[model samples]
Target chain A: MANPSNNYYDLYRHGSLGVALTDALDELIGQERIDPQLAMKVLTQFDRVIAETLQEKVKARLTFKGSLDTYRFCDEVWTFLIRNVTFKLDNGGQMVNADKVKIVSCSSKKNEEK
Target chain B: MSNTTVGPVYDTIIAEVINAVRVDFEENGVDDGALEDLKKEWQHKLSQMKVAQFPWDPKPEPQAPPAPAHAQPTAPPPTAPPTAATYTQSTLSPQSAQQTLSLPGGLLPNANPMGIKPEPGFVQAEPAIKQEPGMQPIHPGYNPANGARPTAAQRAALALESQYGQRAAASINAIHSGMQINPAAQPQQVPRPGQAPQQHMNPQQQYRQGVAASMQQRMQQVPGARPPNGLPAAQLDGLNDATDTASGPGAVHPIMMDRAQIDEHLHAQIAARAKQMEGGGLMLPLKEATKNRSLPEKPRKADGPSQLDGLDDDVKSEEDDEDAINSDLDDPDEGGDDDEDDDETMGHMMLCMYDKVQRVKNKWKCILKDGVLTVNGKEYVFHKATGEYEW
Candidate 1:
């Protein structure tokens, strides 16, 4: 399997957030709202801080019920296995056990804080 | 880190900055309403930034005017930074001026430094209807002009009509008009004499009428018998007409036999025959005659075994002989002292003889006493110790 980190990096480079951040920074440099060099330094630092904060938030949310043996972060989502979770089915109003459940969490730090 | 992850991080930083700005405005005694307007302006600016294309590297030529508001930010600008410029810069080196002057080689060979516009084919096509945030667009093939198709039940009814419509309508119309498809198809019923005239007669009734007509014609052709006691012919004809009318067409006159009168006549003939046979001495009853008639003897063949004949002769002789023997046995003074001596010895001899007979017959029921062996109601005595009997 391809490395999940590589996939995430590709997504960060090409995705909407990357484009939006680059556009905002370029506009600020054009308007001379702040020094280009200082702004670049701050932006890189901000990116590091946000990644750490999101990773922490995601880890906390994942292990809220219990700790998992393995989890993966890929393509803007966190995937992990859980056990004995109850899920409501759409067919009938029935609740069933989801053994070895695979959960996909795309929730970010902003959403979590909100 | 994914681009989706970057969105939340950017939101957090922006929130922190807003908080700092609010604090500054409050310290400067700015109006709360002004702060709200500033917040709205900042949101608008963020939306605009999301719509713009990113240029990671500084272009050698002057940049073109900004793109239309409708353009999406899916494609990277031609003047985007090389891979090394964008991501390979070491965080330890804060010397931006020296790094900018010393341009890195062998990084992102495809990078265009002139900021060229993208080809028309490279730009993504936009949908006719613009969707708002959180809203999904409807399917492109759906048309509002076409009304809703018929339900399942309606479609089934329409299919049935298409296949069997004409025949069903004809049958319904026939029922309303009171017309029968086959008039003579019903079951035939027997007609009574006084009932209304029937429109149709079955084959059996027609055959019976034809036979009756022929019989009546034959009767008319025959000469009438001489009228009794000088009765008029017209009166006789009137009597025949009355019988015909009373019996109706195809009806035969019933002839009833009187059982009592016939029985009396037969009994007279039987008595005369009995008187002739017996010379008026005795007459065998009719019941005896019937029994004899029912049990006719089967004749025996001349050459076959004569056992049946011998049995009849034996039965007659036994009956006659038994009467004579019983009378002789009843006499007490027929024998003298010689008989008395014989009688005592006869007792021993009779017992021996009975034993021998019992052995031969395999039956023992005789008792000997006073020279006599009694069996059932009969008695037997030994004459000379021989198995012969003198009853």
Candidate 2:
């Protein structure tokens, strides 16, 4: 099933972008310092920033030391589960049974042998 | 069981049973005195049983230690042992605590197979400080000694103070100053009698008054300034001349007439009359002559006798002649006998014969039997051939 278009706060509330910005917004609203409209505007800007960040193709090198066999990506633009893929380790062995892994970067280069 | 093994167990069991029984008695409305006596008896039996079971006292015993004071009359004596066990248990750690509890004297064999002693004092102290890992004491940041963070309400109040406090104070000061200055600038009004009260005149009234004053001043500055009277200038001139007798007849005063003027006016009137008489004498006689020649004389009879005449015979004769002519003209039969007959038959037949027949039929109160029509007491037969009722 295709995922519906969601704003940054919606995705962020589900732990996307590694920050609880929505919780901060909730606290602000709860204290009545900012109204829902202002909160929504802030959320919209955050969403735009997140969408732009996701769209940019940047070179990043990551060293993952775990055994995670399955991973999933979710957001407004992309939503899919990744599984059963081989990953190279900086220390010379591969792990396949990790529970959680972080995606460091994406590049067009083929895997290089050390 | 051997006395060494059963001594603490028996003491513990007996203490628990006494406690249970005491609780049951208290719950069932046992008086405090009876409960105390029962508690003393149980303590004596428990001490005696401990003495009988363990002759070799591990610790030096007082000759007769007073019965252990019961903090709660219904709590077991084994409660204290658990506190000691917990102290030991904490020091020995889990591995050694398990080894200690696995010793032969453990009360619950399979339940605590590791032979860990129950910390009964922990139960008493449970409400004060729970032993569970998750039940750690919460150190609230709002301690007076440490300095407390502001609460949400206090923060909101502070924010409002920052935002509007100065403005509110300034406004209050402004109001105070305005109140202080207002009375000094205002004039106190005192009313006076006999002076016509000053009415507030609107702009329109003021404009009208200004116009009237200007007009009065202009009038006063005129060369021959007249009193502001109701009469107009032209009328005033005539009035002045009329009242001034000094203006002689030759002077031609507007009101006074001259004798030569009267004579001239009379001569003009006489000439006008003479001219009118000449025109009328010539035209009128000619008009009368033409009229008398062209029109024939009307008959005196056609004019009829005057109604004002006192002669009754002439009036009567004229009225008789008028009646005779009117009667002769009004007679429609004069036109034709056939028309007269038609009008008479059509106009009179329905009104006379049909009405009389309808009245007769209405008048007849009758009933018919066979062909006879009965009316009142008379029986009349309907004759079809003659189309009439026959007796």
- The DockQ scores of all candidates, in the order shown, are 0.01, 0.00
lDDT of 1 by residue, A1-114 (tens): 112212121222122333444555566556654446533443443343333333343221111122232344575444334333333222234333333333333423232342
Extract clashing residue pairs from model 1. none
What does DockQ come to for candidate 1?
Answer: 0.01
Candidate 2: list runs displaced more than 4 Å.
A1-13, A16-19, A61-79, A84-114, B1-391
Return the top candidate by TM-score.
2
lDDT of 1 by residue, B86-198 (tens): 11111112232122223342011112220011111212211100111111101001101000111232223223322344333333233312322232221111222211121
lDDT of 2 by residue, B1-391 (tens): 0113323432343344344344444554545454344334444443432333332344553356676766432232442321222222233233332333334532111222112122322233232222221111011011110011123332232233233543333443333233323222211111111111110111111111211222222222332243333223422332232223123321224223345434434443453455455653455466453332221111122234652232233334434444444466556544565344333322111000000111152132112111111112111111110111111
With candidate 1 superimposed using the best TM-score fit, by how many Å does residue A33's alpha carbon deviate from the native? 2.7
Q: Which window of 10 residues has the lowest lDDT sum in candidate 1 chain B?
A: B138-147
Give the worst 10-residue stretch by lDDT in candidate 2 chain B: B349-358
Worst 10 residues of 1 chain A by lDDT: A58-67
Tell how far residue A12 is off in model 1, in angstroms.
4.1
